[model samples]
Every structure is written in C-alpha cells, then in structure tokens.
Target chain A: MKTIKSLHARHHELSDTHHQLEVLNSEIFTRHYLPTFREKLKTSGLLPLKPTGIEVFQMNVGYMCNQTCKHCHVDAGPDRTEVMTKETMKQCLEVIINHTIKSVDITGGAPEMNPDFRWFIEELRKEYSGEIIVRCNLTIILANGKYLDLPDFYKKHNIRVVSSLPFYNADKTDRQRGEGVFAKSIEALKMLNKAGFGKQDTGLILDLVYNPSGAFLPAEQSLLEADFKRELKDHFDIEFNNLLSITNLPISRFLDYLIETDNYEDYMEELVLAYNPKAAEGVMCRNTISVDHAGNLYDCDFNQMLKLQIESKAGTHISEFDLESLNERNIVINQHCFGCTAGAGSGCQGTTT
Target chain B: MQKTYYDPADLKKFGDIAEYGQDLADKFFNWYNDVFKDGALSSREKCLIALAVSHAIQCPYCIDAYTSDSIKRGASEEQMMEAVHVAGAIRGGASLVHGVQMMNKAKKMLM
Candidate 1:
C-alpha cells in the first residue's frame, strides 16, 4: 500500500498548486461536516442554481500578478507564466462581439501583465461598445517603467478601473498586500485622479475593492464605503467612485490559512449559518460567464479558479458558446458557493442584496 | 433537553428573544440599533469602544460578537488590539488607583 501526504502535510508554508488545493477543498467541504450547499439552498428554495442571463463576460487573462496576497483566491503572483495567447484573445473578442455582452470584465494575476493585454483591449475597443472593466491590483500600475502610462491608457479608453486596496492606511493594507504596497497604491490612485478617474461626472469611473484582511465576512457595504471615503480623503487625499465590500471566498491561500489556523470548520459554519436566499438568487454566476486564460468557460470566476468547467453538450470554450444552451444549463456549484450567498451576498459588482 | 449556563449555539438565537415577548424585545432592539448607528463618533469608533468594553466586562459573547464587528467595521488588527489594551489599562489603573485609600489609612494609623 502507498500513501500520499496531504498537501498541507507535504509543505510547511503556503504554495500554489491548483490540484492539491482542489483535493483539500473536496475533503474539507463534505456532507459529513455539514449539509451540502445544494441541500441548504433547497431548504431555502434556491436549489438547482441556473443562469439568469449573460450580462457580463469576465475573462481571466492569466495567473501572473505582482503581489501574492494572503487571501487571494486566484493564487496570482509574479512567477505565473500561464498567459492568454493572442489567438485565445481573438476568440474571446469574437464571443464578446457576437454575444453582445453588456459588460466585458478583464481579470488576471494582473490582466495588464499579459503581453497581448493592450493589443486585445485595443482590438476589443474597435468593435465592443459596452463597458470594459479592468480588475487591477494598484501596485501593478507602479510596477515598472512599462506600466507607468497605465492610468493614462485606462483614461484614454474610458476603462472602468476596479482595483483592490485592502484598507485606507499603510498598516493594514500593507499587511494584507505586500510591504510598501500601500504607498505605491496611493501614488497610483493619485495618478488615476490626475487622469480624472475618480472625480465626479468625469465619466472615468474608478472603484475600489475591500475584502477582509482576516477570517471574517466583510461589513455592510455602505457603511464601510463611507469609512473608506472619509479615511482615504482625510489622510491620503485620495478619491474613488465607490467601495465594493467583498467576502473573501474560502479557496486558495485563504483555505490554507483557515485549515492551518484551525478555523476552517468554524468559518464554513459561519458562512452556512448566514446563508441568505435573496443573495443566492442574485448571485453573480447567474448573470456572468467566466472565461479562463485558456479560453475555457465556467459559471463564474470562483468556479473558474476551481477548474469547474461549464457542462454542456455543445462545448465550454470561447470558440463554441451556445448562449441558449448555457442559459438553460444548471450552474455548477460546491461549498465555495456559500461565499457568494452568505450574509448580504458577494459578487464581482459587490453586495447582491 | 440538556441545559447549560452557556451554549455557543445560543448566540445565533439572540434575535429570538422577540419571539417570547415582542413588545419589550422590540424596544430593546430599537434602542440597541440606535446606539450602534453613526452619531458624533463613527460606527467603527463605536465598534472599537464596544470591543474594549466587551473585554473589560469579560463577556465571551460580547467579545466574540464585537471582535467580528470591529474587524468588519474596518478596525485593523493593530487598532483592535490597541482598543483591548486600552480596556486593560483602565481596568488595571482602576484597581491601582484604589491603593491610595489603603496608603492613606495605613499612614494615619502607623505614622
């Protein structure tokens, strides 16, 4: 008989191995621990999750990011080389144009890090008329000389920049992100402001994302937004259109933290205990389709990260999108679905309910 | 059917108090709601204060609730801990300050 050590046992520190973490996810989110997420939803009349519409097409360009945050579900970092090729981008563009997606969201380890990112966006601008969102980690804006003109580029294209800033101050923000990240993020925000990103009626919308730095659900969006607005303005003289409070999904680095710190079961229980049917109804997966760097499709970004492909007879790839069939297909879900349905509910656009 | 002084599960049933008696429970909830809202001090500040008091009173329920409340309300780990330290300082000083009475009484009798 042969035995393999659990990923948690094999390594003493956090590392990104999708399969390893996926195995852990399977083990941790089981019926023995609690009722299956689907069962919980069925009890509340929200089972058999299905798509509402494809209003947003979110594309994960790659797995390369500048900073490796502790709670990043994507496990994006500097070393990741899995980037979307020009061919895939072309296919994605075809889907966006043909489907006429109302909003096309681009994400990544850092979407901008993709070599074809600018080219793809430029090509996308040529045909797509809807809103384009870039999920940027602000540090990337100041990463190097090559990225210095990013704010200007976003402004030039009227891109709605949605960036993550864990907290308003250096201490908390830096602790969650990496060291000196707070300062650089501030400088980037100032640059975006200079480019008319966050100003009122500027038509250059800038949004900030806030996720809890530890094992907890985010506070009410409006109150936290007000606090962020006041603190950022008073201290850094920074400005943004709105703050989106997002729940940290239990996956990737966060899952490791929960398991290692002996908080996994408790955290899952909290999410299950706070299950909100209203939120489940408005889950982003219902309206958004996620496309990975490889051009494969999933119900949402969380599903995409977990390698859960959309199940359809036609196929789940950018080249073969049967919008009708996808609309009718059952949305694949697991315990991670709780992150989107818990409490006020979390989505790419912020609180669902 | 088991009975205990404290059940961790009961924390989730805190809102069920209104089920037993709606009138008084409603009043308590309304007052509690009003107290935590943004006033002269921000809600985050109120949470920090609540966190400190929760520690001083040493109520595990309050501590658990406010710890999550404070973090959710944007209180940093450092800020939250500092709030706890403030509670500790005040509590410690409270006992130490009473030492003056002991010193005065001893001086009057011995000196």
Candidate 2:
C-alpha cells in the first residue's frame, strides 16, 4: 500500500512535468524554466543563519483535510491515517511547558480534523500561555456539525488563524481547492470575520496564505498581498491581515502532480538557475522544528516527507527532545532546497525576506 | 509515453543540497548573485536563459524561480514561451538520439 501510494503520488508528478512536452519536443516550458538565474553570477557555500529561538513550534496534526486542493503538497485526503494522537499532543505540550517556546503553529490537511484538536487547544490555553497559530483550510470548519462553531472557539482562545484561499476568483479557487470550495471557504471566512478574525485592532489575527496555482513560486509577497487584499475586499468583501507567499516544495502530492504533468525538468532547471543565495540565507528549515503526528522530529515538513532524519542523533522522536539536544540537531538538506531559497524565499509564515 | 519522472516542485527545496561537494551550493550561490548583478545580461536575460537551462536539466526550483524572475525582469510573455520551446528542442533531440542505438541494433540483426 505504501509503495502503491507513493506511485500514485509519483504519477501526479509526472503529469505536471509531462504537460510541457505532450508530443516529441518543441517544448517552451523547459527552455523558459532553466539555465537558472545564477548563471553569470557567483556561487557561495555554507548558508548563513540567524537564530530566532525555539520561540515557535509547529506541528502537522495529520493528513486529513476537507478540501483536496490540486496543488496541495501534502496529498492529504479523507483516507489518510496519519493524524497526531492525543498522547503525542501531550508530549508536545510537555515541551511547551518545559521550554521557552513562545508560540505553537498547528497545520495539517485541516489540522482541525484531529479528533482531540479542540481538547488539545484547550490544554494549550490552560497550560502553555503562549501564542497559538492555526493554519486552517477554512472550509473544514464548515465541513460538518462538530466544526461549525470553530471560528468562535478560535476567537475565544485568541488563536491566530492562517487560512488558505488560493485566489479571489471562484473558478480559480474551485479549480485548486475542489468544486464549490470557493463559496464554502468564503462562507467560512465570513464566520471568521464576524468574530473579528481579520478586523482592525481586534487583535484577533487572521492571515491568509497565497500559493501559486501552477509550477512557480509566488511573486513578491508584498505585491501579491496588496493585490489579494484589494481583490478580496472588492469582490468577496473579505479582509485578512496578511498574505504569505510560500514557494511550494517539491514533495508529496505536489511533486507527483509536477511529474505526472511533465513539468519536472523545466521547473527544476528554473529553480537551479534562479538559485538566489539571498533566499538561501533564510530558508525556514534553519530555524523551524517540524513535529509529525507520531512525535518524530524533522527539520521541516519537506525533510519529513523524504524521511531524512535530523542529524542531531540524540534520536528522532519527540520523546527524546532535549530543547538543547534538539538545537544540536543538524537540519537535513537536499537539492529540493533551492525552491525555498530561490526567490524571496518561503516559510510557513510567509516570504522570509 | 516513455514516462518521465521529474518533479519541478523539488526545485522548491532550493538550498538544501551539497551538489558536487560543498562547492556546488557555494558556486551556484555566487553565480546567482552575478546573474542579478547590473551588467550586460540584465536580470531578465539571466532569468530566461536560466529558465531554458532549467528545462534542459529539469530542476523544478529553477523552473519556479526563473519563471518568476523572467516576469520580474520584464520579459514579454511571448519571449518566455519561446525560451521554453528552445529547451524542448534540445531535450527532444537528446531523447530521440537514443533511437540511433535502436536503429543500429535493428540493422545489425537484419544483416
């Protein structure tokens, strides 16, 4: 099942890459994609780092999401069985209690899907006393009976909600998120806004995520945010705090989409050529510690997918997390890194520029 | 369909590698800076060519970065499209050339 599943993911990738050359050649995509932005430049080694403290810790609760967006890198779906267990959540909380970690970022297919999510949040509220970030799909809250009041719940706890709304246009959003998702998401956003999620001075923080619909990194986050803010306000009457432009890493379902579509070569070449050292200076993996549902620690979610164990060697799981020891862990890396460091750079929060 | 398995999204993991030892990342890094340097090619020229080469080697990160870079450098839509085509030709040629090996085998068998 694992191999077959990986194969399915691989097929999606081939599809994305294949689209450029349906027939023999004369492909425009590859040529436009490579030789990189680095040619005619210099290359440097040993990426620099500026520590941000273990002030923030983010967890991927599971792979179950309400919307199976086409470009979703997680490949999360209704059947994925990888949600973090409540026990694991406790382990995470233990770290919060013991460490100076100031914030917690929770993400997943719809991190809200985890059965004990509400309970977990309550635990954090009562115990951690730090900022909480919830990366929501928005539509999940409207998925069914149990989730209907999540927006209000989030507001009561003062959790920061970072929602994904790919585009302002219904067709584009639906195309990416799933049929009718655009409307449902907008409705959910309304619930959030009513609770002052994106309102002025409410301190109910609401940030939106904007990832490219195709095989490209997003434009400047500031520029894209301005456009998104303008468009969403004008059309859907939607208002959010900020837009984080993430350069989608080549992994999981998104990787499969690229390969399945034949967008592989050209896209990789583009990333290589545009290899901006400036972007590399701030790749999120340098500072972020990604905790999987099972308590296994990874440098970032991308490294998690490849199962590249962190170099700390104190051991892999969260049970072994010595904040000091975890700090000692050497973040695993690979060629896929160019994506994060290529442009202005990408991270869970937004461009790291 | 011979089935190609390249993932451009992989390009997103841009700086995580040590290509050709440590120098790979370092060299690429310096070249990247040079490309953006205010000189003959302009960042736009560097972007298009990078995009083209990205196709030749097929790095998704490169593809993603250069695609954005080209647009930022003020490359016309048509020009970017044409650059991709240029890459397609080289890739196709590389692939079909293997047909010569097949042809050689077939002729030798017939002879």
Top candidate on TM-score is: 1
Each candidate structure's TM-score, on Cα atoms with residue i matched to residue i, is 0.86, 0.70
- How far residue A263's Cα lies from its native spot in candidate 1, in Å, is 1.7
Best by DockQ: 1
Query: What 10-residue stretch in candidate 1 chain A is worst by lDDT?
Result: A1-10
TM-score of chain B of each: 0.90, 0.66
Task: Encode model 2's per-residue lDDT on A145-252: one tens digit a residue.
Answer: 899999889998999999888777776677677788888889999899999999999999999988777676676777678778887889888889998877776665
Total clashing residue pairs per candidate?
Answer: 0, 94
Q: Which runs in model 1 stand beyond 4 Å of their true positions?
A: A1-33, B1-46, B89-93, B96-111
In order, candidate lDDTs are 0.85, 0.74
lDDT of 1 by residue, A1-353 (tens): 11222223345344444653454456545653666688987987776887888999999999888887767787777656789999999988888888858999999889999999999999999998899999989888888899999999998787999999988888788777878888989999999999999998899999999988878889889988988999889998889998998998888778877877887777887888889889988999988999999999999998887788998668999888898889888889888888999999999999999
Give, for candidate 2 chain A, the lowest lDDT window spanning 10 residues.
Answer: A1-10
| Per-residue lDDT of A155 in model 1 | 84
Q: Quality of candidate 2's docking, in CAPRI categories?
A: incorrect
Q: Score the docking of each candidate (DockQ).
A: 0.67, 0.09
